[model samples]
Target chain A: MAIQQFEHGKMTLEQFEILLDTLGTNFDSWPKMKQAEARNLAQTLDGKRLFRGAQKLEMLMMALQSTPQSTSQSVPESSSESPLVNSAVTPCDTQKEAFLEKLADIPRRYQQNSAHLTVCNRMTLFVTQALAVNSDGSRLFSPQRLASQAAAFAAVLAVGILVGITPEETPTGSGEIDLSETWFVASSDFELGE
Target chain B: MPNRDKADDTILVARVCAGDSDAFRLLVIRHGARFRMLAMRFTFDQALAEDVVQEAFISLWLKAGKFDGAKASFTTWFHRIVINKCLDYKRKRQFSALPDGYDRADPAVGPEVKLAADGASNRLKTVLSALSERQKTAVILSYYSGLSNQEAAEVMQMNIKAYESLLVRSRAKMRKMLMAEKDDLFAAFA
Candidate 1:
């Protein structure tokens, strides 16, 4: 009883099935020793059915890869409109080049395409999130966002002046009206009444 | 004979690891055709397949120093590299007229391979695209690329059992889909 159960190894039917998912219908690809076990399993009624099913599928896959030359050449039987083209192209002949002519430019093309993509994305941002126009025709930028961004920017400039500008400019007596502080007032005035 | 070739590859891979450009070129030329054909399974377009092969070798050349002879053979390592590159290209771009993109001679290529990549692989690819990513990869590496189950496992970075499990499921799915396609075709004939 134990031998009967253990014939398939510790690999349960479920596990065996999971194994089948990756290996396809071929037992040859199985480990050299296990190939015998796999073939044995394939001989069972269910296994045979599965094998037939997979064979039909495999045949379809093969049909997709290389249609039988006879079938393609059958003319009346074959649906292909141009037998001329079919005869002209053989798999090995076409595969000879291996398509390496465009090799050197791949990186360059990727670089250019990626740059183009980035620019397109940046432009897309302006169209969607950045430039999202509201019901009215005015710019989509909300006052709150503008105000928040302005505040953050002003804080950065303030830190820069006290830490960088003041140290250099203060030591030289070139205070220069502290334009960092006054520019906001001028900008606010410029936006007034509009 | 295969063993000797394998040994030769080991030498070539080592030379490449040592920064020998000529060795790297030889490796490219040696594996280029196979890589291109493998890539063609992923991208039915010959031009795109070549692009995938080109990127694979370029990546291999850049990463030659990382090749660990003890862990995997050169062929397995390089196959993984090429498979990943093909997947990357597929992810980035949408492939149209696949498995059959070679219906006409691409002006870019000379007359040799122009006619077809196995007579319009698109029918299979369209159906194959329905599979999960791992299933698709398994079928391509195992069925299309002709990597043995064990080699395919290495390429997928999965254990033998796990890879087999995946292949089984993939084959089952393929059977179901292909059967459906056949029935559809028959019905059309009717």
Candidate 2:
């Protein structure tokens, strides 16, 4: 069969428009199999694939950005033995506060990792939760909280990596301890000592 | 709610993968309408279509980490997800027969018709229904979905030449159907 191929690629604007009209008008009688196949094709060709590298970069950036800043800086430097000593801070409250503080640092770390990772405006809630937990002064920062914080941060970092965004290297001599990683070491050491 | 068009899908997927609830919301808004349309075609019911779209978006949030640009376009991959969900819906409907009915009440005749003001679109839909499944799919992908023949072939899992043949046959059938309809309408009017 001598099938006429419409030069869709090279057609002038007017020609394209005409072709569009013709195709549009005739689309209804297309075979059922063809319609299903075309729908499938249309689904595939509409947009560019979401790149893994870009996605990873984005995730990492968000995680870092959502982390809370260090409480040692955010809290007032009082001469009191413990800021919560007079305030009747519960262990749970202290833990929450510590978690929040760690969470706040995430964004700054993300910035250090990559300038392209912008703070998502709505992510403040998660950051605030991280901060709020630190300030509560009830529970001391628990291993679980730290783990969650680490997981969140890791998830974001993974996204950054996926999206081909080179995360800024961890700042040298930032003096901030990675509590999540340190906790495992401390626990293992304590077990060995016992 | 995040601003539409401000954050791209790649960024949103990244955020969601990073555990950002807000980023997921933006994705829902960005692709919801398109997903809904795809679902509607597959399920033939508005409510089921909505469910399919929502489920597809949720899955997107969970699996955003798996997205790789080199494998396929985001839209295409997402469509595959939506289609799979719709297929699942079809299976469920077959067993339970969902309450919603797909009464043969003209699927494509809607607000767009008011804008066109011509009988062209209605005629098109009628002709589309007349086509065999594969040919109909080929025609729709080429004409409406805006896929290249090669991409359409890939989606259909067919050889390029076979896809070409399908398109040719589909277009010829559509041309014949439309001409016949026009003749019948003119005869009736006369």
Runs in model 2 deviating more than 4 A are A1-194, B1-8, B42-44, B91-126, B146-151, B157-161, B178-190
Q: What class would a CAPRI assessor give candidate 1's docking? A: incorrect
RMSD list, candidates in order: 20.3, 24.1
Task: Name the candidate that leads on lDDT.
Answer: 1
User: On a 0 to 1 TM-score scale, where does candidate 1 land against the true structure?
Assistant: 0.53
Using TM-score as the measure, which candidate wins?
A: 1
lDDT of 1 by residue, B1-190 (tens): 5655565566565554444455555565455666776777677666777767777776655555566665877889888888788778888988654344445444544543233323235456766788988888888887666569888999899998788777767776777666554444422112
lDDT: worst 10-residue window of model 2 chain B:
B181-190
TM-score of chain B of 2: 0.62
Tell me chain A's TM-score in each of the predictions: 0.31, 0.18
lDDT of 2 by residue, A115-145 (tens): 2234642243334233332334443446677
lDDT for residue B71 in candidate 2, whole number 0-100: 61
